[model samples]
Target: MFTGLSAFPLIPTDENGIDEQAFVGLVARLAAAGVASIGALGSTGGYAYLSREQRALTAREAVAAAGTTPVIVGIGALRTRQVLDHAADAHEAGAAAVLLAPMSYQPLTDDEVFGLYRTVTAETTIPLVVYDNPGTTHVTFSDELHGRIAALPNIGSIKIPGVAAAAAPARIAALRAVIPAHVTIGVSGDWLAAGGLLGGADAWYSVLGGLFPEAALAITRATQASDSTAAREASNRLEPLWALFQRYGSLRVMSAAAETLGLVHSPNLPLPLLGLDPAGRSELEATLLRLGLGA
Candidate 1:
């Protein structure tokens, strides 16, 4: 009955890349802190920049760190085989589920999008989480497409980004209204936990869970208990941290936030990302301090 949940931010590495042991340790900490799941190599985790090998290695380490908890592997790519390969890797790595978004290279027609999800679903036996984040991937799967995908047996769930949180309840209810009860609808916004829960999402894929699982878990539990007051209180307390996602775009800020929280070695990002500048760093630090999460 995980009607609400949180996931660790998959922070990327500098030049040499993420330390396997350190990454595993981060997941272990998240698991200990009560996170229901872990997401590695995501936008927050810099999935796009990771080499295929790095992605697989990160998945393996994440699954190992999760131990008993579920690991949701991000499998968005330009090619279907690549996504299938990631899903296969997740299965091999002992992941509980796989999350995927549409390919970013080309715009897909509704029929094409449905076909892609159907094809991917056919390849994997594990539970799948369809990702809908128009911000990063540039396109979103329509509700019709989502319903079509949700109808499949192995299509376990869908994780809509936070921007959709306000509209999620009715939208999800509409989707669920057509599909069976087995498929779940989840949200990926760190600040939208309460709204997502209230809106009827089954779980939350949190970016903050990696650095502050305690706060994320507390808020989720409060929402699940139907304590709107407490949920709002926790969400308010977390506003400063969630604002960090807005300060610098998602990926770079996530790394910077990880650095501010001392979850990672440095704020160094991959080429083209080049980490954050001084102003960005100061904003990140201010957000951290305001949230009482000292840098």
Candidate 2:
């Protein structure tokens, strides 16, 4: 489940809360596209902003909608107990696995982060993916810390942040040496996925794949077939989208894309988080049309 394209879809929401119909449609689309797994409630899914009830409902809906494709539900929360509760909810929802990011308001120590994983692994029955997204979580996992956590029960895959293309091979090698053989290394950051895969990363936990599975699969399959040129070319084709992600952040840009593509209605993001500005939206729409992704 962890060793291929895992699409992390946005969980569309409005003032009334989760838009189940739109969210289910998104999951079903990924399933039909034959993505190896569907990641629900990940950072792209706006998990951190949702309440427990909303997240649980999203998990259930995603699992139900995904059919045979695996569903990996994110169970990250500020508190350990809350995370455990979310994990249990994911288990009850029939998630194939759970993704855990060490979320923190206060800056966390290496030991504290390790302890968080220890506690969650001790309690949860579902296999957990270590989500190392420092950009949002504010908690970084050193390779040594990852080794420690990977040794814990239920640690199935480690989702690492993006590294430069040149450094990808060595970066993946270093992680491979520390972590156990059974624990797969999944790359986040869509732009880095091709390099990471070519460098020996096992899977792609991709935000872009969630919205455009065929496009992401093009890169993933090309890399899997050992066609580096094709993979790089595929990734290069999306350079404009990656730039937009860098400029406005993936969540905001993707929300706008979803609206532009008519997958969801406007004001799709949770309150306190806004979509892309007019100029950014215009630029994104133009880029999308150039790439043949505009609605």
Candidate 3:
């Protein structure tokens, strides 16, 4: 469940709320593409914006649509109680695993973050993925903190943020030395996925994979086959898309891409968030066409 490409699809929505049909189509598309897992309600899925009921619905639909593919649902919330509730909901939905990011309005301390994991893991039977995305959650995890949280039962995987290509090997090695051997290390940051995989990370918790699994899987398979050159080449081929993600943030870029592909209606993001502007959309369309990703 923790290895290979875990595609995190966007939970398409509009003023009427979650577009269940589009969301299910995204999940089914990923399942058919043979991604290692379908990561619904992750950062890409806009889990933080949805109500508990909405999130639970998304989880149930993702698992159902994914069929044989493993489904990892994000269960992050501001409060531990809410997180526990979300975890229970995910378990009830028959999710293969749950991903948790330490989300907070007030900055959290290392101990506070550790306590969050300890409480959830102690109460839930489902496996947890520690999402270390400082970019979004604003909670950073030191190697020491990661080791402590990973020591808790049900700590299945750690989804680490991107490291530079030069540092990936040492970073992964350092992480491996501290955590239990059973606990896998998955890499986020789509641009750095190939480097992370080649550097010995166990999985790619990918944004691009959610929309375009075939492109992401090419890199994953090349890495699995010990073809480092192929993996790097595959990643490099998507550099233009990666550049767009870096410029506009993945959520917005992916929303625009989904709309362009007609997978979902325009203005798919949640309230207070808007899709790309005209110029950005034009650029994205050109890039997509150049990459042979046009609808």
Candidate 4:
């Protein structure tokens, strides 16, 4: 489907803050690069740092820039009401779907998590997608939960980060066994594109797609088309590029890579997260050069 070749975390950042114009350019670039969908205000987009208005504005900008492509707004928040509110805003702002995580207040009971998705699905007309990123949320929704949620008419997909890259294939296979055909399984790990495709993921969401949409899309399409050799070569070519961010962390180093490639003006990060250091910057640039990504 068109959804398989999209970029998440098409974030807006500059030396100052969210760069509206730059973000518009980013959307256009992703569309031209052949991305069929895009997501904003996701974890990597620093959604927590944006004010409510900024969040809505970002959604609007993304939708406006995306043209005919689908834009999914990240509606995840620490509160249920907030997620519902964001879902409303995103829907009004032209989002085709909303991606949300379970509330972060406490370790949720299975019933509570199930109820949460039920409530969200009930409250929104737009399609809702479950986000499963155990590294950040420390919660892994069971396949049982996915089965239940995926059965909901409004639930469209599950975004699962392949953080445990090695074990991802098994987990993905298990997830695929339960989820419905229309309810997609989205992988969110930078290095697990081919593996995820082979394991039955319908689509992928990761910063790897943001920095290298052309290459990531190529790899995903190849794998989906059963071209194992081409997919392997594509992944191999992107290994050093992924390593550049893997070595220093995706969020921080990706901003630097964006700046180095002239994709964005500066690596402006949120509070408590410092921008790249000189040595780190030098190393990232060198790695990007080696990957032939530093424009």
Per-residue lDDT for 226-279 in model 4, tens only? 887888788878776667666777888877877787867765676677768899
How much is the lDDT of residue 173 in candidate 3?
99
**What are the per-model numbers of colliding residue pairs?**
1, 0, 0, 0
lDDT of model 2 at position 101: 93
Off by over 4 Å in 4: 14-16, 163-169
Q: Which run of 10 residues does model 3 get worst, by summed lDDT? A: 10-19
Q: Could you estimate the TM-score for every candidate? A: 0.92, 0.99, 0.99, 0.93
> On a 0 to 100 scale, what is the lDDT of residue 245 in model 4?
61
What is candidate 2's lDDT per residue for 1-295, written digit by digit as tens?
9898999999988778988899999999999999999999999999998999999999999999999999999999999999999999999999999999999999999999999999999998889999999988888888999999999998999999987778999999999999889999999888889999999999999999999999999999999999999999999999999999998999898899999999898889989899998999999999999999885
Q: Residue 233 CA error for candidate 2 (Å)?
A: 0.5
Screening candidate 1 with a backbone cut-off below 3 angstroms (N, C-alpha, C), the clashing residue pairs are 10-45
- Rank by TM-score (best first): 3, 2, 4, 1
Model 2 regions more than 4 Å off = none
- For candidate 4, list the clashing residue pairs, or say none: none
Cα lDDT of candidate 3 equals: 0.94
Candidate 1 displacement at residue 292 in angstroms = 2.2
Better of 1 and 3 by TM-score: 3
Residue 53, model 2, lDDT: 94
lDDT of 2: 0.94
Instruction: In model 1, state the lDDT of residue 27.
Output: 82
1-295 per-residue lDDT for model 1 (tens digits): 2245757565557777766665776788888876777777677777877878888888888887777877888888888888888888878887777888886677777787787789988988887788888877777676777778788768877777674546867866877776668877777767776787767777877777776787788878887788878877988887766676666665667677667666677645777676678888898788777777674
Q: In model 3, what is the error at residue 92, expressed in angstroms?
A: 0.5
Predictions in order: lDDT: 0.75, 0.94, 0.94, 0.78
